[model samples]
Structure formats: structure tokens, C-alpha cells
Target: MWRYCSLLAQLVMHLDTFRVSRWLKRWRPPPWPALLLRVAVYSGLWWVITEGSGSGWLGLVLALLIALCAPLNVATWPQQLRWRRLPLFIGFMLKNSLFGALIVAQLALSRRCSANTHTRTYRFRLLKGHPQQLLMANLVNLTPGTLTLRLGCDTLSIHILHYQPQIEAQLMMLESHIAALYGLDHEPWEYEY
Candidate 1:
């Protein structure tokens, strides 16, 4: 009975240690780039709300306030960008955005066109931080056809306006570009799609 009790106590201690380690791993200081993005978005919304009036200066202040007040729940800061790859990524986004817009317009304007909308959950290979998930969500939301519905641990639930076999490929390509922007070198096993 003494030995069994000792084993049970040891197991409880080990479980407590595991829980503490997991908690420590999850909590981290937020990064600067994320703060900057929040500030920019808040400021942009303020400007829009004020309608380009003489109150633009006030908008900037409000933006700063909101950004500072917002809670940050980052696990780890995303990897730094490879500055050399930024232009390429930007160009890729712009080009794809233009085409996506054109396709959306065609689907909208053509009476005979039928859009096969579908939602899919994609488990990414290399995306790690919340920042990467946020960026991917925004990118998908902004693109004409795809709407990012939810982001979960290692999974993105996206609604595609026009579902096609190639849509998954396009999304993977987009993810790769984003990974490049984050300076992540992808390992084949890290990606599910």
C-alpha cells in the first residue's frame, strides 16, 4: 500500500509539471510588427469614420489609444521576413488579386454563370503563430472569391465562392508565399496540403 501511494503521488507531480510547461509555452510577449498592424488598422478605421475632416489628427490619437488598449494573446512572434522576398510576394498578391477580382466580376455579371460555393477546412504545413494565421485569414478574405470563416489550431476554414479542383492548389501557393514572407523554410512533412 505504501509503494502504490508513492507511485500515485509521483504521477500527480509529473502531471502538474506537464501542465505548467504547456502553459508557459502558450504565453509570450506580443511582437512589434503585430502592434504596428493593429495601429494602422485602427487609424485607417478612424480616418474612415471621420470622413477626411480636419479631425484627422484626432483619428491618429484614437488609433494609438485603441491599439494600446487592445489585448494581445500571441504565443510567439512570427519569424522575421526575408526582405528580399517581399517585393516578389507583394507582386504575387497583387497579380492574383487582380485576377481574382476579374473572375468575381465575370461570375457576377454573367447571367449564365453558376458559382459552386463550398467550405473546406485546410490544415497548413508551416504556419505557426497567430500572426501567420491572421495574415492568411486577411489575405483570403480580401481575395475576391475566398472568404476566411475561421482559424483554428493548424487549420483554416475557408469558404470559396467558386469551388474548383485548382482552388486548393491556389490556396497552397498563397500559403507558400505567406510562409516566404515570414522567412519560413518549409519542410515537406510540415505541410498537409
Candidate 2:
């Protein structure tokens, strides 16, 4: 009986230690660079939304609040964002946006528009709950004729206005660009029709 009691006490101690370690890990502050980057990005977004209406103090304050309140997983950010690839990613998105606009314009102006709209479910190579996955979904919505209907754990359901052979290729390219931005390898995944 005494031995069993000792073992039980030991187990309880181990469990407590595990809990403490997890708590510390969860509450620890993020790295300085990552924190600063978050603040800058948030501030920039606020500025863009507000169109530089008033003093930048409110934007700075909001940025700080958001940065501090958000969960900071330092391990992910360093591996996720590659600063060198930012320009390429932005340029790719802009170019795709332009092409998408042109396609939409052509379809709109045509007298006999043969629109064959369909929904496609593509398997995303990015891991579930990854920030880049959400960003990619938003970008898809911004692109003309393509709207992200559902973003599941491993699948993305997109509504395509006009089914084109090159649409899948463009989506793949866009995914690759986003993966590159996140410093992740772009791998082919099984997609559903």
C-alpha cells in the first residue's frame, strides 16, 4: 500500500511539472524581431484601411494591442516567412490579379458568354491552421472569377466562374508562390474534382 501511494505521488508530481512547463511555453513572449514585424504589418494594414486620416498614434496603439494579445509561436514565424521572397510573391499576386481582371472583362463584354461555372476542391499542401493558408484563401477571393467557398483542414473549395484549363495551373502557381513566401516546399497533393 505504501509503495502504491509513493507511485501515485510521483505521478502527480510529474503531471504538475508537465503542466507548468506547458504554461510557461504558452505565455512566453515572442522574439523581438517577430514582435516588431507583427506590429509593423498590423500598423501598415491599419494605415491602408484608414487612408492616413489622422495621426498614426491610433494605428500604433492598435498594432501593439493586437501583437500582444495574439498568440506568439516563435518557432513557426522564422520558418514561415522568408523576407527575400516577399517581392516575388507580391509581384506574382499583382500580375495574377491583372490577368484575372482581364479575363473577367472579356467575359462581361462578350455578347454570347458561355459561362461554365464550377466548384473545385483542391488539396492544399500547406499544413492545417497555417497562417499562409488563410492568406492564400483571401488572395483567391481577390482574384477575379475565383472565390474561396470553403477552406477546410486539408482542402480548399473554390468557385470558378468559368472553368478554364489554365485555372488549375494558375491556382497551383499561386499556391507555390504562397508556399515560397512561407519558406515551405510546394508539393503536389491529391485534389478532388
Candidate 3:
């Protein structure tokens, strides 16, 4: 019985689906430039939270700890942010959010309702990360007509107060903007009908 159990264990370890080779692959550290950038951001946040306290070492240690703990993926790093484009993106979001609020208000107050509202399961191409995906979901919810009902591995189910086919186009544009913001691979955008 012991011999049979040992053979079973070895066979299980060698199973095709249980390949340990992937873990044996080289584990690369994040780029120095990105790491430095994260440390800076974390330091700034710490400064804000601490209200400009002079406890410098605390902030530095915290920043280093957080940066080291962050997932080591070049594509998902916050350091990829195009600082020059952030203002433009912020302006875009503000304008859209205002527009969405106004539109939703009008629909709510108008006699003819349900004219353009839609529900869709939009499949996004953005690299999957909790932070990025959560940002995308929250941004969509902030928009007037759209509310993110569910966020999946590569899909977001949204309920729009005002539905139009053109909303899909708008979402694609939003996704593209987000992709640029995060320095993610620009995968061709596709959606389920």
C-alpha cells in the first residue's frame, strides 16, 4: 500500500495539468523607473495622510513596503501613467459626468421615459487587474446613463438609463482612454452583441 501511494504521489506531481515549470520560469523584478515612481506616489500619499509631518523615515519605509508588495507586472504598473495626458483625461471625465447627470435628470423629469436606456454586457480588452478594472467600473457608474452591474474577468455588465447603440462606441472610446492611461497593451476592442 505504501509503494502504491508513493507512485500515485509521483504521478500526480508529473501530471500535464500540474506543470511546475511555469513557476520555475524567471521571476523578473519590476523596472527601476516604475518602482521609483510608485515610491514617490506612495510617499506623497503618506505625506498627505500624515499632514506634512516630518517623520520622513516612516513614509519612506511605508512606500518601499507597498511598492515591493505591488504585483510585479510592467503592464499593470501605475508608473505607466502618462502624466501629460492625465489632466486631459480628468477634464474629459468631468465633462462627461456632468453631461450624464443632466441627461439622466432630463429623462427622469420628462414625460416620455425609456426612450434610449439600455443594458449590455460589454467585454473589455484592458489588462485584468483589480485596481484598473475597479477604476473602469467606477468611472462607468459615474457616467449618467451607465451603471456597472457586474465586473468579470473581461466583461462588464452595465445598465444604462438611456440606451443607444452609440453608447457602445462611447464605451470603446472610454476604454481606449483608460488603456492609454495605464500603459496597457492596446488590444482590439470587442463586445458581445
Local accuracy by lDDT, each model: 0.78, 0.80, 0.78
Q: Is candidate 1 or candidate 3 better by TM-score?
A: 3
| lDDT comparing candidate 2 with the true structure | 0.80
Going through the candidates in the order shown, the clash numbers are 2, 0, 5
Candidate of highest lDDT: 2
Model 2 steric clash pairs:
none
- Candidate 3 residue lDDT tens string, 105-193: 88878887756656789887664767777889999987668999999887899998766768888887888788778777455645445
Distance from true location, Cα of 144 in model 1, Å? 4.9
Residue-level error in angstroms, candidate 1, position 39: 15
Candidate 1 per-residue lDDT, tens place, 63-181, comes to 77666555434333333757789898888889889988998999989998888989999887777778887899889876668988899887999999988888888888888889878
Better by lDDT, candidate 2 or 1: 2
- For all predicted structures, in order, the TM-scores are 0.58, 0.64, 0.64
Rank by lDDT, highest first. Answer: 2, 3, 1
In model 3, which runs have C-alpha deviations exceeding 4 angstroms? 1-30, 69-76, 109-116, 125-134, 183-193
Error of 2 at 10 (Å): 35
Candidate 3: RMSD to truth: 8.7
